[model samples]
Target chain A: MYRVALRMLLGDKTKCLGLVFGVAFSTLLVCQQMSIFFGLLGRASSVVNDVREADIWVMDPSVKTIDVPYPLRALELPRVRGVEGVAWAVPFFKATVQVRTHQGMLENAIILGIDDASLVGVPDAFVVGSIDDLAEPDAIAVNPAGFRLLFPGEELDVGRELELNDSRAKIVAIVDAAPAFAANLTIYTRYSLATQYTNNGRNQLSFILAKSADGTPPEVVAERIAARTGLKSVTSQQLRRESIMYVLANTGIPVSFGTVVILGAIIGVAIVGLTFNQFVMENIKQYAALKAIGVRNVKLLFMTLGQAAFVGVIGYGIGLGIAALFFSTVPKKSDALRGFYLLPEVAVGVAILAAVIVILSTLISMRRVLTVDPATVFRG
Target chain B: MTTATDTLAVRCTGIHKSFGEGEARVHVLRGTDFDARTGEMTFLVGPSGCGKTTLISVLGAILSCDDGEVDVLGHDLRALSSGKLADFRLANLGFIFQQFNLLPALSATENASIPLVARGESVKAAETSAREMLESLGMGDQVHKMPAQLSGGQQQRVAIARALVHSPRILICDEPTASLDAATGNTVMGLLRDAALAGDRSVIIVTHDNRIFDFADRIHHMADGVITHIESPDSSREDAP
Candidate 1:
């Protein structure tokens, strides 16, 4: 029975290849596009994740998204410290400004300045150099990934310098592979440098980064700060949503990605459906003959579904693999493509759509299956 | 219930079937009675679309008659549920279609092994039995050749081998000789004759080829879904047990 089923599925090379390719194309598009999109989103909130490092974050008033203005880091820092469950409170600086580099005037860099003493907001991985390098005045940390982009495949020494703001900053550290998602070109500087860079105009930080002591819910600390400081506080998980909510609502990203997703799903279903329908139509006689031989209906259905799954899984995997390879090798300067980076949850969501399309497209032809009077084979 | 006729391979009476509903409804079979006992070869011959295949499907348990009594291998077809009817067919019936219907991707031996494997036999044992059946039909050397690799005559022989592999009590063929040349058709018909008559089982071939009529122990001609005439080699074809 398996032999027959195998024959039924791959009997014709043309049809089998068509099915595989249809699935492959769909997989590639969905994976590659989504990877870059999510990669960008991760970058958009890099400063928040870096500075807070906390289980929770509190914002000013009813702030939503990391871009929202918070009360001066000086004023809220003490109020958060006064909270019952509070273990630690620190100031974080986030702003975007143009930076002068060898490549060009790179604009809208998410500038972050962690307090001079703490250094809590630095990139986690450093491909080259160590943290002690950031200790020097007029010194800053640069991502090796960015350095490589400005000077491809070449290493820059610590003494090398780039001018940002009016201050002449020397690169004391070259951090390798620090891929901060969005801030792939990030340069780490002291809080004072950030103050001078932005001219101390606002005189306030983005928000506060806090850590709760043992066995304390971040919600408790957040509520304490909200009641005492009255500067609306939120947990890190809530901050993550707050960080993304504005960009999602204000920007046209949802509409754009939503359109692309719909197109991807439609094309996926159409290609697979049309191609697989051809496969089944060509094999109709074999199915009829199998029915004549007393092969049960359910078994035949299983074989079809199994073939579909084979196409879906293999094509999806191969497509994503190819897409990922393409994305990884892409120069950072290229239009930000993360290439279908998704967690298990995202993969499941994508599959639900594909599976429904497959079943829907195939179900239309099942009528022919059920109607296949075994007598047709007897006559023909 | 204990009559000696209980040993019969097939017994049917008053089979009725229809298609569609209300104004579109058409009766295909009405009060049709038929039989093909053990060790006999019965041919149900009719011209195009006269319900020979439909009747065969009903007898093969692939189709259920609307109202009838059908007893095959001591199991009442009308009484069994749809699933059990399929099980009965799997256990006892072997079918060959007119088109030499072998799965294209599979080798001839694999095609012949389908019934046994469908009945849940292991692949190893199934192919072993398939090889034996194919060898009996002179397809032993071509066991591993896909359907495309074999000539039409060889493919038909493989089909015949498949129908007989499970040692079914009833072997049913619809136009088994349709695609073959006269010589090849005769060879296939001879294999059927030997398998049914010599082995004490029954073979029913539904074909209009009068040349193969003598190969059957009994030939039944049908027109408009009713059996018009039935002639047997000997009246004692279904002798009392």
Candidate 2:
């Protein structure tokens, strides 16, 4: 009986292929868009957690996310280090300054400050003259991804400086692949280097990034830290989702994806329904013939639904394969596009989508197939 | 009145059928009484619009007579529910349409085995029986042919083989030879009569082709929704001349 339905579909390969590709195309469009959208949300908070590799983030109690507060001082670091589960605590600094690029001065270059000793916030990409230059007072490091945007052209060995708030700073080591907080155009300097130009003193600093003691739950330590100090403490994961939601909610990503998923489901209904309807309609004569010779309506129904489900299966398998191949071709720098997790999430999502497609369309076309008049077998 | 000559395959009395009512009523079969018996081939002969096909359909349990006691195999159709009637049709009767209706997607063996397989026979057993039946009917070489691949006579042969696959108590054929030439029609009629008479299973063939009158063990001539004549081997009109 399954073979019977398959034969019917294969009888018109062109039409069946048209429908399969139609659904596959729709699935690819919707799933890739979702991956990129979630990837975008990931980008907005990548530096706040991923770069620092922090287990917990301690910020002002009033803050919902890491971006809410300015850089904090070395004084709070001591208070946090004394906490039971705290292994090491690092104070990150955020300072906006006028960057004098060879192209033009850009205003929103987010300054990331970490002292040279632990360099807890600095990633391996730090290169060029080196972190030792941070001891040179006015030197700052910039990630290579944003290096060209910050320094547009090659000028002679001359003094080019960026002024933060009031004071000036010089370029130091260049890092590679390191993430930035606000936008891609970022400059990193030592805490002492940034402090020279700091107008707000030790009071205005970014959240404290912390690594917990072994066996201590980051959530439990975060709760303790928030309770001990007047600041709120969130695990890096919590802050990651919160910071992402902070940005995504503004961009309405949730609403957009909700719409796409719903539209995806409806498109599934339309594609499978119309396709199955046409399939059964074209093969109705065969069904009448089957029925007249004593084939049960239930058997005919199974054959019809079996064909629809087979299409769903084939289409989903093809679509996911295409999506994986597409994702693989992307270069490593495409962090935004590199985040498709085909494990539990996509497996469940595609399963739900395919099942819904099969079940809905089978039921829609079932009414027609079941009511077929067996007497029509005599007509032709 | 039915006789002890054979168990009544079908008996319809006061059968009335109307498509609509009042001024729009198209009475297809009105007050038609008919009978088909086992151990004989009953030819239902009538002109177009004479309701012979409708009467045959009623006999086959495909369509119910509106106001008649249609008894098949001693079970009164009006006394049974629709579902029971359908089950009776599936279990005890077989039908061959004028079109030689066979699922084009199915092979000749599968097509012939539909009734037996559908009634819960194992596929392997049904296929074997169907193959043996087709082989006996001289369609052994075309067992794998689809309906579209077979000639009209071949297709009709496959239909007859299917009708007898389960050894049905009665076989009702509607114009089984309508689409065949004289020779092919004679061949098909011979196969149908032999199938009916060989097993003592009743057979009713509804057709207007007078050329196959020799195949009939009994003939009920119909006109204007009425049985106008009953012909038997001894009293057949062909013997009068």
Candidate 3:
């Protein structure tokens, strides 16, 4: 009987293809949009994720996201260092500056100043030069992507020089830093050199990066620092979550992506429901014949469900394959699309949603099959 | 020796059935009494809307009557629930429809195997049985063809094979020859007649085609929701009061 049901579905090639296409289209749309949405959210907190050594970040009380930092006074760093359970603390400076390339092109760049002694907040991976090179006078590290922007068509060599704040700066290293939300050029230098380049009045400290002692959780140390210094302190993970939440609360990205996902589900339901119903309607007499020939309604129900499951699995497999291909290839080929990939959680969630769409459509069509009179088969 | 009443396959007394209600009410079966004996072919002949199909539906246990004593193959149909009734039908009865009602997607052997498959037989075993039945009906070369690929006579042969594949105790057919021409209809009727007298099985058919009247052992003429008379092809006709 299940074989019979499958044959009946496959016999009508057009309707079967239509049903599969509806599910596949919906799965692709929902998964692709959701992956991009999560990818963008990840970019919102990329800076926090890149500085892996810092367990705690202390900033001014008003800062909500990593992109919009409110600087704390220089004295607050010593206070944060003085707090109990604090293993080490260092000054971290972040400021936007304009860089003039040797070719005379000007672009905005983010300058991150790490502690001169520890180099604590610098990116760990370097593509061109060693970390020791930053100790050289007027030396700085630029991310590979930022380096590409500043020196188009140039090889990733460490000898490139740029003018920052009318001061000569040499790029001694090309680091593989996590991409930022604005995708601006990122330059890393020593704290004192960064202060000399930026004129931001007296309080120039953007954040105090700290590490908690052994057996002390970062959240507890952050609370102690917040109570003692009267500044906002958060664990790295907390900051990453807060950064993503801030974007979700303040931006239109959620609504825009959410609308596409919802529309995808709606279109999936409409297409599957109408096509499945028509398929049932066209075969109502055949169903009646089965019913008259001693096929119980329960058996018929299972057959219908079997057909729905087949369509759902096949369609979802095709859709997920396309989505995975997009994530694998597109990010590597385009600079702007870098760091965006499909999440496993998003894949599992979309699969459940696809199952729901298929099951809902099947249940709706089952009603007609269950209610048809077997006597109608006698009516010719 | 088995008496005619002792071998009765179906017995219905004062069966009443109706459709709709209030001013639109239409009574389809009005206190009708009917019977079909084992080892015989019983034909119910009537015009459209005269309740021949309704009576057969009741005898087939696919429909419920308003009030009646309905016994088929020695079991009281009224005592069975819908689920049990379905089981009984699958175990004991087979049906042939007016349009043949073969599933278009299935090949002739697969269509003919439905009753056995519905009764929990494995598809392979059922198809094997159906193939033998089809070959017996002279459809040996058409077993693998789809319904659309077969002629009307071939489709009807497949339907007959489906009806007899399970070796049902009673076979019910409604308008089995309506869609076929004279020669094809006669051929189908001959196959059905052979199936009826082969064993203790009883075959009941409701049809309007009089060309094949000679195939029936007994014919019940119905009018206005009641059986008007009974005709024996080998003897004199008897009128009802």
Candidate 4:
């Protein structure tokens, strides 16, 4: 009977394809939009994620997100280091500065200043030169994406010269860093050199990156520092979440992406419901004949559900495949789309949503089949 | 212990059925009495809206009569719940429709195998039996052809095969030949009579086509929701009210 039901669905190629297209279109829209949404959230905290060695981040009390940071006084570093369970604390400087490329092109670049003595906040991976080379005179490391932006047609190599805030700076390495939300070039240099370049007021500390003494959880140490120093202190994970939450609270991204997701679901239900109802209506006489010939309503229900399941699976598979192909290829070719890919959790969520769409449509159509008078078969 | 009437395939008495309510109510079947014997073909013949179809629907257990003692193959149909009635139909009854009602997606063999499949037989085994039945009806080469590919007579033959596939105890047909030409109609009636009248099986046909009247052992004439009279091919007509 299930086989017969599937044959009935597949018999009308046009209608079957229409149903598949409806589900597939819904899936593609939901998955692609959700991937981009999550990817954007990830980029919001990309700076914090890149500095893997820091377990706790100490910032000014007013700071809410990494992108919009309020610099702390330089003395906040020693204060955080004096707190209990603090092994060491390093001064980290972050400020956006204007850069003049060797080609005389002016662009905005974010400068991350790590400790001059330890270089503890630099990204661990490098594409061109070694991390030790940051010790060179006026040395800095540029992320690969930033390097491409600064050099355009040039291959990745160190020893490029650029002007930062009217001061000469030399790129000693090409670092691998997560793409930033602002889509700006990222430059890493020593804290002292960065302070010299930026020349902000004496309060130049962006954040204090701290490591908890062994066996002490970062969350506990973070609470201690905040209580003692009257500053905002949070674990690295907490900061990442805060960063994403700040974007959600302050930006229009959620409303924009949320509207598309809702529209996708509505369109899916409408398409599947109407198309399935029409398919059932067109074959109503045959269903009545089956009913008259002794098919129980339960059996008819199974047949309809089986048809819905078939279309749901095929449509979801095709849609997910297309979404995966987009994530796999598009991000590689486009710089702005970097770090965006389909998440497994998002895929699973979309699948459950697709099932709901199919089942809801099938139930609506089944009402007609279940109530059809078998006596109608006798009338004609 | 069974008497002659006890062995009858279907028996109905004072069957009352109506549609609508209040002033719009219309009585479709009123005090209708009908019976068919085993191993014989019974025809219910009447003009349109004369209650022939309603009487057969009651006998087939596809519709409930407002008031009646309805029995088929020794089981009282009015005593059965809807689920049990469906079970009884699946186990003991078969139906043929005017439209053939062959699923256009399935081949002739698959269409003919529905009864057996509905009765819990494996599809493979059901199709094997259906293939033999279709072949016996001289449709061996067209077993795999879809319904649209077959002629009207051939489609009716497949319908007949479907009706008899599970070897049902009672076979009910509604205008089985209404869509066919005279020659094709006669040919289909011949196949139904030959293939369905074996083995204590009762075949009841509700049709308006007089050309196939000679194929029935008994013809029950209905008018205004009641059986007016009964006629036998071997004897003169008998009047019953």
Model 4: DockQ against the native? Answer: 0.78
iRMS per model in Å: 1.8, 2.6, 0.8, 0.9
Q: What is the TM-score of chain B alone in each candidate?
A: 0.91, 0.93, 0.96, 0.95
Candidate 2 global TM-score: 0.82
Report RMSD for candidate 3: 2.1
Give the DockQ (C-alpha) for candidate 2.
Answer: 0.33
Clashing pairs in model 1, backbone N/Cα/C closer than 3 A: A31-A340, A35-A340, A35-A341, A36-A338, A36-A339, A43-A182, A56-A236, A65-A242, A127-A176
> How would you encode candidate 3's per-residue C-alpha lDDT over B61-94 as one tens digit per residue?
8899999899998898888898888888888998
Worst 10 residues of 1 chain B by lDDT: B1-10
lDDT of each: 0.73, 0.73, 0.90, 0.90
Q: Can you write out model 1's per-residue Cα lDDT over B1-241, one digit (the tens) per residue?
A: 0011224688777788888999998788776777887877888887876778778888888778999887777778888876677677777888887788788888888889988888889999999999999999888799999989999999999998888898888999988888889999999988987888556777778998887777866667676767777766554333211
Q: In model 1, which regions exceed 4 Å deviation?
A: A52-59, A68-90, A101-106, A116-120, A124-137, A145-154, A160-167, A175-184, A200-218, A235-237, A323-367, B1-8, B21-25, B232-241
Per-residue lDDT, model 4, residue B163, is 85
What TM-score quantifies how close candidate 3 is to the native fold? 0.96
RMSD of each: 4.5, 5.2, 2.1, 2.2
Candidate 4 lDDT over residue span A1-380, tens digit each: 99889989999898899999999999999999999999999999999999999899999989999988788877888899999999999999998888898688887888999999999998899999988999999999998878888888778998889999889999999998888887559999999999888998888999999999999999999999999999999999999999999999999999999999999999999998899999999999989888888899999999999999999999999999999999999997766778899999999999999999999999999999999998998877
True lDDT of residue A81, candidate 1: 80
Per residue, candidate 2 scores C-alpha lDDT tens digits across B1-241 of: 1122477778888888776778998898888888878877888888888988677767766667778678788888778765566677778888888887666667899888877767777888989999999999999899999888899899989988888898888888888888999999999888887878677788888888888888887788888888887888666553210
Ten-residue region with minimum lDDT total, candidate 3 chain B: B1-10
- Tens digits of per-residue lDDT, candidate 3, A1-380, equal 89999999999999999999999999999999999999999989988998999899999899998888887778887888899999999999988888898799898888889999999998789999989999999999988778878777778898878999999899999888867886558889999988887877788999899999999999999999999988999999999999999999999999999999999999998998899999999999999988888899999999999989888998888889999999999987665777889999999999999999999999999999999988898887
Task: Write out fnat for all predictions, comma-separated.
Answer: 0.67, 0.28, 0.75, 0.75
Name the runs in model 4 displaced over 4 angstroms. Answer: B1-6
Ranking by lDDT: 4, 3, 2, 1
Q: What range of 10 consecutive residues in model 4 chain A has the weakest lDDT sum? A: A176-185
